[model samples]
Target: MSTMTVKRAELKPGEVLCSYCTARCCRYFALPIETPETWEDYDHMRWYVMHGSCAIFVDEDVWFLMVYGDCKYLLEDYRCGNYEDRPQICRTYTTDECEYDNDGTYDRLFETPEQIWEYAHAVLPPKKKKKKKKSATEVSHQKLPIVHI
Candidate 1:
């Protein structure tokens, strides 16, 4: 099927930009999530990506989990079916920072579980190596106790 796209540069003065959009914003929803610091936190993010067409992104130092699900009120014509009664969040969405105005790019975006895992491995500190246990005879003859600092 053919689709129409209007560039921000070509928009005429005072013209509504959303009318020319394919409802990009309506096709996805993003909610802020806790920043992944530890491997476990990133593992949770990886789990989210494994579920479906979801993405984890870091934008402006904030992390978010984006799910690709079209709004039920989205019409075939790329308009809101319930425009008048749309929710407050949708109503407050401005075209200024919309996907229509510019490309929707994040600081760091991960679409697959492997990407999150790779990122976690790259940033997180290496795991400490485990010390081997001493033999029973060696331990019994040791002069000093093993002290972990």
Candidate 2:
């Protein structure tokens, strides 16, 4: 039997953090949203997508409103200025499960209002139109049975 040797890869200083120069994880945050069930709900979501740096996505059946904006703590070099005293949420975030690793995990992502509108047209029911009622004058104009005194 022949024996084989394996070597582990080594990372340079700040290599893991430096690799993600764009700081994608620090640039955006998503808030949970109720699944749109009506045209109004879908229309509101379309309005959200119409704004700059705003988007919507679904992951594992959960929908979210994603807002893109750089974190106040992120420095110009893509480093966190308050790394030592970062929030618990930030501290808990792991690089292995970051957006940089899996950018295609979103089931549906809408980057523009047109995209959301297209989806709405496919999934939402058509709006119903209310019929106009006949006026009293129009009703009086109809032929009526003659009454004799």
Best by TM-score: 1
Instruction: Give the per-residue lDDT of model 2 (tens digit) for 18-103.
Output: 45446778898999999998888989999898778989999989999999999999988778889999999998888655665454
User: What RMSD does model 1 have?
Assistant: 5.4
- The lowest-lDDT stretch of 10 consecutive residues in candidate 1 is 1-10
Evaluated against the true structure, the overall lDDT of model 2 is 0.79
Candidate 1, residues 1-149: lDDT per residue as tens digits? Answer: 12556677777899788878888999999999988888789889988988998999889999999999999988898888899999999888898878775667889999999999888889999857789999999988889867999
Best candidate according to lDDT: 1
TM-scores for all candidates: the values are 0.78, 0.72
List residue ranges in candidate 2 displaced over 4 A: 1-21, 131-149
After TM-score superposition, the amount by which residue 86's alpha carbon in candidate 2 deviates from its true location, in angstroms, is 1.9
